[model samples]
Target: MNVNGTLINYYFHCKRQCYFHGNRLNLEDNSENVSIGKALHEERNKCNNTEIEIENIKIDKLTKEYLIEVKKSDADVEAAKWQLLYYLKVLKNKGILRKGKLEFIEKNKTKKKILLFELTEENEKELCEITNNIKKLILQDDIPKVLNESKCKKCAYYEYCYI
Candidate 1:
């Protein structure tokens, strides 16, 4: 499988989760958190059809100056940031360049967090390395160990890792 934005996000959040998803374990549908995230995206898209699909990646919102990614939580900003960077690289490859914007909108919170990023030559190089690493990670014979962190509790693959 090609290393997409989700895989990039998972690589930072949890290697094992990335491996499971990359290898098509497909347990996210059973997670409430995943459902809520999908619902949030659907609701926002209904309000304004800013969502766009280009090749293998789907952008939540794309404006003239920014490629915005909407997230339900900022709990894993590193993961989200890398995911957005990967998207930026994809866009840059397609001759579409824009700054990356990550918006964290919680379930009941009125205030959202916004962070902006621009893909530089330095990061783009790092992202290439990350993509290669993910490709190798998922092809391994043995699964990665469970992360055993607090974040694991909310992960969609929690059961697979813990139970």
Candidate 2:
């Protein structure tokens, strides 16, 4: 399965949450937040930029080695970073990126920009391990428990999970 920004975000929040969101449950019926995020993404995608390859995965913006992730709130930072890191890792794996930068756009403004770098061998190993674990969870027949209360509040799956 392809890992996208949302999956990366879910993984950062909680592995079990990622598994639940990705496999055992569906949020399409109860996700105004998700709809808003998608709208924001469509807005951002309107900006034109050159493309660069990172391990057969194209970096979204290539001109300045910048990866822009638009978010509606500051709370989205961690999730955004994880997604960017994964991109960086992909670039490193393909030897396509020496360095990268992250731009977190909030409320139509640049809230934060930081340098992103290639992951080391150990980091790649850890990433593979984590990805495998997530896949295992998804393949299971039973849904994992809700691991934390904070997750419920911010989760797009909140209605399906908590109600």
Best prediction by TM-score: 1
- Taking the tens digit of each residue's C-alpha lDDT, what string does model 2 give over 59-142? 557544445433456565666666666776765556655445565555666455454544567767767776677677677778
What lDDT score goes with residue 155 in model 1?
88
Candidate lDDT (C-alpha), each:
0.93, 0.62
Q: Cα deviation of 156 in candidate 2 (Å)?
A: 1.6
RMSD of each: 0.8, 3.5
Q: Would you list the clashing residue pairs of candidate 1? A: none
lDDT of 1 at 97: 95
- Clash numbers, per candidate: 0, 0
